[model samples]
Target: MTKIANVRCQLVDLEPETARSDASQSFVKQETVLVTVETVDGMSGTGYSYTIGTGGTAVVAMLRDHLVDGLLGADARNVEQIWQRMVTGTRATTVGAITSLAMAAIDVALWDLRGQRADEPVWRLAGGAHDRLPLYDTEGGWIHLTCEELVRNALAAKAAGVRGVKVKVGKPSLTEDAERLAAVRDAVGPAFEIMVDANQCFTGAEAARRAHSYESLGIAWFEEPLPADDLAGHVRLAAATTVPIAVGESLYSSLRFAEYVAAGAAGIVQVDAARVGGITPWLKVAHTAESFNVPVAPHFLMELHASLACAVPNGMYVEHIPQLGAISRGGHVIEEGWIRPPESPGIGIDWDLDAIDNLRVA
Candidate 1:
């Protein structure tokens, strides 16, 4: 057994092509806390935790303070035991927030180690349940792009062989939001699947009003129409709108999702592998969501979700955005509308050392 030798982490602040926005702060430079685990046998594994350009230092500190001590010198093969030691072992403080983020890094690293040791791809290790995961173009989300630009972008996705697309629609004015959504729907035609995300940028009444107008457009789903923490609001919106209510990215646990399911708040689940404490808990949430008859449509990290979407029956579309130039190495190739999972062992993607250098921000 290879004993765990060392653990180290870094914060990578990567700039986007332009300022990206919704009803909240708008900017590039997404902050990511990257974790690296090394073993006595010279094998090492890597993982990352995502944040909105802040909380990176805190995430790294949590791993250094709480995780490194318990993780080092342990058997790298005993992944579950180590994870439990770091998570449930600190029940009073470990159930949410920074701790979950820290666990995300450690969990992903272990899976990476397992894949390398077994000499198989992580997707295969996780059991390659399908050949490919479907893709959805998700960048036209109200980042100040015009309706024509939005339509052009949607058409480009179709031209690229993508079948579905999502756009943002919380402009404060319901009329303006409606027109933008309608324009895109008209451009994409009736058969193509178009999803709308409010990014928690509306009131329950506003959500219902906007959703009512959007229903005429044949949208595939309505995502985060209200703040994620507002269960009552979500329940109200879900009840009021004929459009399917979808959410889950802001939620930090499968436990949190349980409330959403019980309240009948969401019909679709958007589990983030990084956000839900990495692949382990994310799968747990997927299973739980399935039991509730809710479909899993993961948020961000398309490369990571490729295998995930393929592996679960209720798994829906994977959000496709090119944030990988920030830390990810080669993993998936988008051919037509399908995103292929990496065939390499453990997570299938590596950090491009050279690209990492260019992305450094003090």
Candidate 2:
């Protein structure tokens, strides 16, 4: 094997002009860390890890001070060792969230390099992957959206061939939440898959009450009904209501995933591509959830997950918000409710460096 050669990282500030809203928060900006790793063989790979908006600086710092230092001269093929070493650094500061975002950026690049080396796509390398992955539109719903507007997006999703549609809930009280779900339910009807996300904006009891109310509407699942770290609350909501809870995007660790799995707190696992350290731990989590018979439905960065979802048998659905289309050189195309996974090697989604650079604020 060629000696591991050079590694570099960059922090990018990509903010949207207008804030896009969801149930719990508004996305006023986006922050991404792009990691590029090069090898002595002249083989190079690209990766992306995300903090979304505010944590880009911290993530960039970890790479400059710790992550890149650890990777220098390390065997590029020893992906596991590199990953473990990064994890070790976690004992002190625990890259849990910060480092994983960094790890993901690097890991994805490495995987892309691997695929290019073999002249094969990532989905093929991961295993025998399907050509398409089912998708559900997240609709980018905000708190200000009227019930009718929420329903309109749901209809749009159905018209787009999306088999499933997810909407925002948690409107300050259970009564309002129920009313919103009711509107979305009526708009889309009983056959179309409907899911609601609280964005972890409610108390355990509030989550439970909302869950109970939506049960009659046949909601597929309740997402992040309680705060991400509220393990006991997760358990409470899972137990108290007939609706199963879904979470993991804001969740930071495999051990935490184990916590939710063991407690039977979450039924649907929504892992993020960049959040859990690129494809490595992301795949690990999918495999882990499979053991518990839980369905894996990934969160944002749908571009990256499109291939991943097809490669894994347990993948349930991909959430589509459509804003990233402007940034991604050639964004994933949504066709008849299924995304045609990128045929390019590695994660397959093109980063559009110029676009990324053009959007850089700092």
Candidate 3:
């Protein structure tokens, strides 16, 4: 039986090439926790998870000092058991970010090892529902962009054959946000989709007000319209507007997602694999959404999400934010607004290890 022989975790800090901003948060840099798991038979798999800009070291330290020790002598293929062990071991922090992020890094590495052993890609192993997924561009729609810039970028994306572009909402004036969306819609025409994200910047009343105006512009969905924990607010927002209320990236647990799904609070579930504790739980959340007939449009980590999005039938649009451009070894394919899952065995991220080593800060 293959057994986990060693585990290592390190921190890497990657700066964005351009400034990114939403209503509530600004894009500074991304801090990822890289994890490597080696089996006794001399095979190794790599996986990682991230924070938008901070807490990388805490995740790495949790993996190195606490979570890694728990896996010694355990069957490397027993992903579920290992995930539960990590969850139970870190009971104090299980519902929090640091613990979930640490567990995600390890869980992902374990899945990579499993896929490598089978000589199959994770998408196939997980259940290949589709080989190609539609892409949506978020990089071009940051809150700081002028209305002209927004229209220019949306038109550019349309020219490139992308299906949609996500615009940041929550400008000081609702009229400004509306005008921007109006310009983009008029530029891209009726065929192109425009998604709006508020990044949890609104209260129930405010989100309702904006959602009403957004619906008139034919937005595809209203993302993070209300705070993630405000399930009632989401329900109200979902009811008040015909626009789909998309949420999930800010949520930390499958149970939390279950609550949202059960309440019919969200129409699109934006499950982030890193935030949801890796591929195992991410799939659980995805399937959970499927059970409720809600579509999953996952948050960042495009390189990895492209595979997961293809693996499930309920998976929808994959957010296109090239955060790993500098560190990714570049094997996945994108053609005419569609992403083809990597054929490589495992999660398909070919990290430049040397670059990662150089970027490690802790």
Using all chains and alpha carbons, the TM-scores for the candidates as numbered come to 0.94, 0.94, 0.99
Candidate 3 versus truth, CA RMSD in Å, comes to: 0.9
Q: Which ranges in model 1 have alpha carbons more than 4 Å from their true place? A: 89-92
lDDT of 2 at 123: 75
lDDT of 3 by residue, 126-176 (tens): 989999999999989999999999999998898888999999999988898
Candidate 2, which ten residues in sequence have the lowest lDDT sum?
322-331
Error of 3 at 330 (Å): 0.9
Clashing pairs in 2: 31-52, 46-109, 47-105, 47-109, 48-105, 90-94, 104-278
Q: Which one is best on lDDT? A: 3
TM-score of 1: 0.94
In model 2, which runs have C-alpha deviations exceeding 4 angstroms? 331-333
- Native-referenced Cα lDDT, model 1: 0.81
Q: Model 3: which residue pairs collide?
A: none
lDDT of 2 by residue, 1-362 (tens): 54468887776666654456766567756787778788888888888766645788888887888778777788787676778877887677654788778777878887887787788788778864467878887753556788888888888878888888777776777778778878888888899988888888887666766777888999898988888988888887788888878999987777778888989998999988788777878888888888999998898777778778777778888877554555577636667888877777766767777887786643
What does each candidate score in C-alpha RMSD? 1.8, 1.9, 0.9
User: 2 or 3, which is superior by TM-score?
Assistant: 3
Q: Give the worst 10-residue stretch by lDDT in candidate 1.
A: 17-26
Clashing residue pairs in candidate 1 are 141-168
lDDT of 1 by residue, 41-125 (tens): 9998887777776677788878877678888899988887887787766577656777778788888888888889999877777
Ranking of candidates on TM-score, top first: 3, 1, 2
